[model samples]
Target: MRMVFRWYGEGNDTVTLRQIKQIPGVEGIVWALHDVPAGEEWPMDKIAAYKELADTYGLHLEVVESVNVHEDIKLGLPTRERYIDNYKKTIEKLASVGVKVVCYNFMPVFDWVRTDMHKELADGSTALFLEKAKIEAMDPRELVRAIAGNPDFTMPGWEPERLARLSELFDAYREVTEDDLRDNLRYFLEQIIPTAERCGIRMAIHPDDPPYSVFGLPRVVKHAADLRAILGFADSTANGITLCSGSLGVRQGNDIPAMAREFAGRIPFAHLRNVRVYENGDFIETSHRAEDGTVDMCGIVQALHETGFGGYARPDHGRHIWEEQCRPGYGLYDRALGIMYLWGIWDSLGRGKQTKREAFSV
Candidate 1:
């Protein structure tokens, strides 16, 4: 596994490249232009600016976290063709920059849903939490307010324009069953996978956050079977999944390590992290360490190592560790800790020569 860190551009992220370089085993950054709205062509100049920054630190810009799919595409609106054209152009632009993997998601309005952002954990650190029971009973207006209340950070799934009419969005999606969603995704991949393959970039689709249907909206990429079905839609290496443990592991019965081994041939990228699941379907993000969280980080890493996961991997969401007043889950302290934990496991597998500490020393 080639280790990477997620840096939200220059001024966008509180974590700096200098600080990211301090993390052991990290050789690159999982980056993107967060300000660029979905379906718009990514400017080559903007991509190059980040490339120069990474070059300065001797790091590669090999993976991008997301190139968000527009809602029109998912809804199968009349304007979808236009958006898909834009997405194809964006893919071409990204490929020109030598980016090997593009991680994107197809979930509706909210990419991922969390009941509370500051849910306190046993380790005295706070993290994103999902109380399943509460979500089931939540009113749409209240849900909108909870999501919008946090003006300090822009929530990935809850875009301002979409959230403005939650009811309309929800109503429009009521007819979009699982099968319809899958068909739409298939249509999308049929059009774009060829470009991705030609450009030598693998398109890894992120699993729905929380891995379930929310607010009566259908979510197609919720489980392993869902991923399998979607991958089969376009039998190209370019069409792949961005296997995130925290997202897929939240649902009971998803063997995350097994996914790494079974989908090894197709998977080009992964997000490694853990979430502690509780009774009544509730779960909270935890340290990426295996022992601390529900997911088996060690076994998963070993599986990837055994499968020869040559694609990019990065530490996913992290807790608010050590009084770091940073973005709720994007704090440097816990994610740095996560990178060390991941490296320790990957190193123990015997393929690695240098310890993370030594490897990180530029």
Candidate 2:
């Protein structure tokens, strides 16, 4: 597994590239042009500039977290063709700078949903938490105020410009269903996978956060069958999925390790993090250690190793540790710690395989 770190950019993030360079085993940055609006082509000069900056820190610019799919595309509006064309252009531009995987999601309105950004844990370190009851009871506009209200950092999915039309977007998605969303995604993959294949870049779709319907919005990429159906949309390796542990782990049904082994060849990116689920259906992000959360971190890594996964993975989210006043889940301290834990599991698995091979040889 090739480990990478997600860096927002120069001024937009509190964590610096210098700090990211100090993290052992991290070889690249999972990045994107955050300032670029959805459905627009990314500026070529800005893409080159990002590559240049990462080069200064000895980090490869190979994986992009998202080139966000526009709501028009997800909604299957007539304007979607224009956005899809622009997405193809962005893929070619990213390919020019050596990007190997582009991670995007088809979740409508909100990309991911959480009730509390800093829900305090029993250990006093805070992490991103989702309260099911709260989510079901609260208005989405209230969520917008709670999440996007932060002036310090822009949340990935809750962009101010987009959520500004929350009511309208919600109305637009009201008529759309799960099957409709799947068809729209199929159309999108059909349009863009050819370009991605030509550019030697895999297009990875991130699973819906929480892997369930939220605020009555339809979620299509939520389970193993959903993943299988998505891969069937395009027969090329360029059509892929980002296996996010924390997102799918909240639901009790998803067997993450088995999914990893099953989707071995198709997954080009992974977001490996842990979340502790409660009897009440809420969850909180935890350290990457298996004991700390419900997700089988070690088992997932072992499966990846067994499958010989040569893809990019990142320590998805971290707790607010050491009183680090940073972005809700993008803090540096805990993420670095999470990286070490993941490495510990991966290296031990590697050593075990080597020992077994040596014993057989002897």
Candidate 3:
């Protein structure tokens, strides 16, 4: 498992590349041109510029968190073809700069939903939390306001430009169903997989945040079966899944460790974070330690190690710690701590495997 950090470019992020370089075992950054809107082609010069920045920090630019799919592509609108062409061009541009995997999602209007960005935990450190009951009762507009309430920074998934037209987007998805979303995703894969294969880039789709339909919006990439179906859309290795633990772990019965082993070769990217699930179906992101959250993070890492995973992995959302004020979930302190935890598991597993081989040799 190659460790990477998620850095939102130069001025946009509070965490600097210098700080990221200090984190042990982190070799790369999962990044994107956040300023560019979906469906727009990324500028080639700008892509080269990003590479230059990473080079200065001695970090590899091997993975991109997202190249968001246009709503037209997800809704299967007639204009989708034009947007697809734009996507193909972007893929080629990214490939030109040595990007191996491109991580994206097909979730409609909202990407990840949370009731509170700084929900205080028992330990006094705050983290992103989701209360299903609150979502079911509150209006999406109110939810958007709450999520975007941190006016100082821009949330990756809940972009104000997109959420500003929430009512229209909701009306558009009203007639769309789960089956429709699946078909559209298949169509999207079919169009882009060929280009990705030729460019030597893997297209990994992130599972729906929470792994369930929100406010009647259809979610297709939720479970193991859904992952198999998505992989079946294109037989090539280029089509794949991101296999995010926190997103899929929100719901019970995901069997994250098993899924990690099952989809071994196909997963080119992973978002490793933990979320504690309550008996009442609520969840809150927590430390990456296995005991901290419901997700068995150590087991998941061991599975990846056994599979010989040679892909980019990053510590996903982390709690607000040490009073370090930054993006809601993208703070530095906790994520660096999470990296150390993952490394501990990985190195111990490696040593154990070596011991077994050495014992047999003697």
Candidate 4:
């Protein structure tokens, strides 16, 4: 596994490239042009600038967290064709700069939902938390205000421009169902996957944040069966999925390690993080250690190793520890710690396999 770190451009992120460079085993940054609006083609100059900056730090800019799919595309609006064309152009441009994987999602209205950005854990370190009951009871607009109100950093999915039309976006999706969303995604894949293949870039779709419909919005990429259907949509190496452990782990049913082993060849990107799930359906992000959360971190890494996964992986959504006061989930200390934990698991697995091979040979 090739480990990468997610850095939100120069000024946008509190964690600097210099700091990221200090993290052992991290060879690249998972990035995107955050200022670029959804559906618009990314500027080549800006893309080149990102590459240049990462070059100075000896980091590769191979994996892009997202070239966010526009709501028009997800809703199957007439204007989607224009956006799809723009997406194709973006892919070609990213390919020119040596990007191997482009991670995007098809979740409508919201990309990821959390009730609290800094829900305090028992250990005093805070992390992103989702209270299922709260989400069900609260108005989405109120939740939007809570998320977007933070002036310090822009949340990935809760962009101010997008949430400004929250009511309208909600109204637009009222008539759309899960099947309709799937068809729309299929159309999108049919249009773009070929371009991705030609560019030698795999288009990986991130699973829904909680692997469930939020605020009555239809979510197609949630479970293993959903993943199977999506891979069937375009039957190509370019068509892939980002196996996010924390996102799918909230639901006890998702066998994350099995999913990793099953979708081994198709997954070009992974977001490995842990989350503690409660009996009350609430969940909180935790350290990458398996004991700290419900997700089988070791098993997930073991499966990836067994599959000989050479794809890009990152420690996703770390806790806000040491009073870092950084992005809700994208803090430095915990993520770096998570990376070490992941490395420990991955290296041990490798050593174990080597020992077994030597014993068998003897």
Q: Pairs clashing in candidate 1?
A: 111-157
Q: Which stretches in model 4 have alpha-carbon errors above 4 Å?
A: 352-362
Question: Candidate 3, 266: how far from true, in Å?
Answer: 0.3
Better of 1 and 2 by lDDT: 2
Candidate 1 lDDT by residue in tens digits, 1-362: 88898887776778999988877778999988887887778888998898899999888998987888988899888899999998888888888778899999998888888889889977688999989989999986787798777767666666677778677878889889888888889999999999999999999999998888888888899777998998999999999999899999998899999999989978898899999999788999999878888998888989998987888888888999789887778989989888888888877787546534553342
Q: Quickly count the clashes in candidate 1.
A: 1
The best-first sequence of candidates by lDDT reads: 2, 4, 3, 1
Question: Ten consecutive residues with minimal summed lDDT in candidate 1?
Answer: 353-362
> Judged by lDDT against the true structure, how good is candidate 4?
0.93
* Candidate 4 lDDT over residue span 1-362, tens digit each: 88999999998999999999888888999998988999999999999999999999889999998899999999999999999999999999999999999999999988899999999988999999999999999999899889989999988988778888988999999999999999999999999999999999999999999888888889888899999999999999999999999999998799999999999999999999999999999999988999999999999999999999989999998999888979899989999999999989888887735432221211
Where model 3 places Cα greater than 4 Å from the true spot, the runs are 352-362
Better model by TM-score: candidate 1 vs candidate 3: 3
Candidate 3 is scored at a TM of 0.96
Comparing 1 with 2 on TM-score, the higher-scoring candidate is 2
Query: Worst ten-residue run, lDDT, model 3?
Result: 353-362
lDDT of 2 at 219: 98
Per-residue lDDT over 108-214 for candidate 3, one digit per residue giving the tens place of the 0 to 100 score? 99988998889999999999999989898889999987878777887898777788889999999999999999999999999999999999999999999989988
TM-score of 2: 0.97
If both were scored by lDDT, which would come out higher, candidate 2 or candidate 4?
2
Provide the lDDT at 237 for model 1: 94
Q: Which of the predicted structures, 2 or 3, would earn the higher lDDT when compared with the native?
A: 2
How high is the CA lDDT of each candidate model? 0.86, 0.94, 0.91, 0.93
How far out, in Å, is residue 205 in model 4?
Answer: 0.5
